[model samples]
Target: MTSATLGPLLAEARADGRALGAFNVITLEHAQAVAAGAARAGVPAVLQLSQNAVAHHGGELAPLAAALTALAHAAPVPLALHLDHLDDGPLGRRLLREAPEAGFGSVMFDGSALPAEENVAATAAAVAFGREHGLAVEAELGRIGGKPGDAHTPGVRTDPGEAAEFVAATGVAALAVAVGSSHAMTVREAALDQPLIAELRAAVGVPLVLHGSSGVPDEELRAAVRSGMTKINVGTALNVALTGAVRQRLVDEPGLVDPRRYLADGRTAMTETVARLLAVLHGAAPAVPSARALPADGISPRPR
Candidate 1:
């Protein structure tokens, strides 16, 4: 089935008081796995690619771009391709242009490392660019703690008033606010400020996005959604699953040099992880029919 735009899917989730799972994709296998998981769970999801992932593949967009578009076309449930955590100015602009042309539904312009005023200014420009191209824009306000590879960064927290002002000034489709969540945490122990989330929701009219969501526990995740989080960005969990699968596969077959043999297991692990998370994000029972249960060739699931 052809995937719908990310904006509509996220808007629907927000209106219905549900959260959409936004999983990061680093390779063709990751894209396929995420789409497959979305299909299995029978829910709308976002397949995002981080700037770090793009850089890993030699800074070229063609390979992953094609992979994402193809996966979207083949997905049985609504799927959106998103550009995640992009900080570089020139590269980000290129991605902004490439996303709509490649059939992506949304793009996130992450300028969190910059000062507050510059971050807002750069994000505002990115929001304008996305709007002009008819794409949904997600901007970050107040830097979230933790670096992608390095240890956590200290002294960054989002203010509700500043977030509201940022959203109003930038006109972004969604706002990612920092409320005590850090990125790249393998353990799910982060504490979320629920009252702050509610305050931010009241302050900013747009959907609230939670970055560094992989670090939050299931209960907190659900509570965040119940409070006001419409979109949750998950990356490290999927990475953990994929790496674990590959590692175990290699341990079972010590001399395996073939990429497909190992990567296939990684994909399966990722799919399972995605399926489980989709159910949680959609607030559906585990026994419910998943996206994978849909006819393998169907465009979309029948209306429930």
Candidate 2:
């Protein structure tokens, strides 16, 4: 199977008035679960590898990226490989330059914390490189909540006027704007600003992404899609589910020492989480996303 790009999935979801679900991968099991869950849900989705995740894998990108690309190719549903939140440093620059070669279809160049001029200029350069290298670039403007400083308060929201100008200046394929979500939240009580989402959607020509979506409840997430969010990014929720399952498994069997036993259960839990979230993005709550048999080619029938 050929590798899938992020644009087609986002475009299809936009046309159907839904959103694309992008889940972060931490370990090999996490990547496997994403593929299995997307196949189970029978929907196109994205698998993301963040900078932190890379650092966890010994600060290397190639080995894991190749593995992720292989998984994306094997899935019958269209799956995209994304390098999420490339931090600003030498490692970030190296990753940005090697993303296409590493089999990534898209990358997010994070310059959100930089000064206004530097952010604009750096993002523009990344976007230009992306255009030449056949990779979609995502950029963030407003300072979202949960940045580990400033007391985790959302002091700045993406002004519609400013967002329009930023997109024009940077030429990004997608823009992750600040509405009301935060990163790495294990709970699900974050209330998104739907009105702001609609306003930003109207302001920017590119697709808008909602980062830190694990904290959002079902109804709020649905409303976010209705307000014109094209890509909904989820990271912490999968970890929460996996950890809970692994803990339970160990409790059930005290003598279980083999890593595979608990990790298998964790993988299953993550897969279920993926399928459930994909259903939310599809505007179909209470999704019947249980694992099912597929054809020999490992492709599930595409949603109409």
RMSD to the hidden true structure, all candidates: 7.1, 6.9
**Candidate with the greatest lDDT versus the true structure:** 2
lDDT of 1 at 284: 71
lDDT per residue (tens digit) for residues 1-304 in model 2: 6678997778878888889999999999999999998899899889999987888888899999889988988998989999999867888888898899999989999888888888999999999999999989999885678876533365457789999999999999999988888887666777888999999888899899999898788888889999999999998878877787787777778899999988888888889889988887787657443222322232232221
Cα deviation at 160, candidate 1, in Å, is 1.0
Best by TM-score: 2
All models: lDDT? Answer: 0.80, 0.85
- lDDT string, candidate 1, 1-304, tens digits: 8877778888899899999999988877778888989889988899888877888998888788887877788878888888887784777778777878777778888877777788888888888888888878898876677775432355456788888888888888998888878887776678889988999888889999998887787777888999999999998777777777787778788999999988888888888878888778877746544323322222121111
State the local distance difference test value for candidate 1: 0.80
